[model samples]
Target: MKRICAWCQTSLGEVSSNIHSEQAITHGICDICLNNLFADRDIDFIPFLNSLSAPVILIDDNNTYLSANSKALDVLAKDHQFLKQKRTGDVFTCENAHLEGGCGHTNRCGGCQMLQLINDTYEGKDSFDHVPVTLFQKHGDVRHKLDLELTTEKVNGLVLMRIDSHK
Candidate 1:
């Protein structure tokens, strides 16, 4: 049978792998579907997030950055262009981000609470509010441990990672 994109019903060709196989991956959406869903108009979220006081960043399923509000930009101490093409670690200047593979590719990423929270929320497993997290941030070759509070909510098929408070 031919596989199809769950979101847009586009044919993806035959399914060679068995559902019972551990290596088999069932694709719910195609790359084109993802691109279309996250097209240029995705930035429209910025204005909406701007209405809120918290720092809000939109992330996709793979933990890739989508867009961030002005408050988020301020919190990261960077402009929109700087945040562009950057992952979570790059945006927050995580120490692991400077590692060989960077961000999600590092071994430390497996135990990352923020990543767990984002994945859980994305899978509809849980939601969080003002959850405290400790992450290492790199500055001038020195790693600083930062205590931060995070709030996450899934809205309009996108996950919103909001920086509620930092200490």
Candidate 2:
């Protein structure tokens, strides 16, 4: 049976050693890539995330919610609208997006490089380190360009995802 890694979708390699024996693992790090993948274990990364120019969110394993910074709340949340919805995908909508019908099902994010980065990590094919991506967003009448630097590492059993924007 050929199994795929959730982080990057890579074919599971020969199990030289089982990191999560019962759950399963790929290479040295699958879900336990960052030593720990939980919230409590990510306190140290707080300072690092806070310093980022772009917003950042530490998504929990359930893909529901975790933690975000002030800048993130401002750009990502946009006056509690997104937080009220409780889903990042909801808040970052592209319905009125001149390009595609919406963000989720558009060429903007559909063929997004970030998604590829995530796919690579989930498949255990890429390191998920310092991967650069460009995303499309509508800022008023202008379609702004956002350079996304995504790093998917584990923190206290959770995915400590850092998303920073660049010019």
Candidate 3:
């Protein structure tokens, strides 16, 4: 695959600046296009994410959902409005999200692997792919566990947490 800017389609030379630069891949925006891609005061991520087949959720530094594609919203059985007012945990129906401190402020949050992944990606630590995660989901009065595979990528300071597959 040819390394090219996701936005301008300019060849990124031989190196792939994407999250998976270590591997032979071709998908990511170039440095020159980064500023303009995000410069718009109201950046709309739905169009970008809509191109993917998987469930993709766009989250900010505080782990708040900025926007999600149809597949993502469908995964949560929610609409755009529902996601706008909720965080990742709330959208995923994490059992611990209902606690006093809510999403990221609870004691249990300390051991949250997914949150750790997000933090790592934000801090430019490393990129991850197909990482397995077990989350307990609450539906009405019942709670169930879901084994999901996560693919995290840092794009323009925003983490695109893509749900690759689930069981």
Candidate 4:
């Protein structure tokens, strides 16, 4: 099979039989390409998901980190424990968060634009949709206010996540 790395336009050097599944899925970029690509990421560019109180970190597409809110961080941590370790692949597995039997994954935890965009992209085959998210935040014993916008864009086949905040 002929494919290009999603993060970079590098010619993958491997024959079909020379590939391993887990690390060689060819999802996007070559390991080296991703590494070089991430090296250019702003080491100080912190996108805070919260405007008040303690801060949280957001692991976007390809392990890029952004700051998040306290409550939202809790939800992501509890719901996405593997994020702290793996920090890649499909982070949100729980669907039907809006359905009756759904885990309600979309509620009050800010918007999971990454997960939702991944779903639409995968499920629709050729569609891109931004998930609509609404959340309420509470700090310790007090609830702070915020509005969040999450978005995803595919660059060279690599999904880049975006989060916007309002207070």
The numbered model that scores best in lDDT is 3
Would you estimate the TM-scores of all the predictions?
Answer: 0.72, 0.49, 0.82, 0.31
Alpha-carbon deviation at 111 in model 4, angstroms: 10
1-167, model 1: which lDDT tens digit per residue?
67766656777667644221211111344567555544554455565556555688888777778788888888889887777767788888888887878778888898887778888878877557677888889899787998888878665466778787876
| Global Cα lDDT for candidate 2 | 0.50
- Model 4: pairs clashing at backbone N, Cα or C within 3 Å: 6-28, 6-29, 56-68
lDDT per residue (tens digit) for residues 1-167 in model 3 = 56666667778777533423532111465656655655542598777668666788888888888888899888778898877857778878889999989988888888887788888889987668788888888888998998888888776677788887766
Q: Measured by TM-score, how close is model 3 to the native structure?
A: 0.82
Better model by TM-score, 1 or 3? 3
RMSD of 3: 3.0
lDDT (tens digit, per residue) of candidate 2 on 2-111:
44444445655665343334321122345543344233643544454555455666554434345666776666646433444243344453333344444334565556
Q: List the residue pairs that clash in candidate 3.
A: none
Question: What does each candidate score in C-alpha RMSD?
Answer: 11.4, 10.5, 3.0, 12.4
- Which residue pairs collide in model 1, if any? none
Top of the candidates by TM-score? 3
The CA lDDT at 101 in model 1 is 84
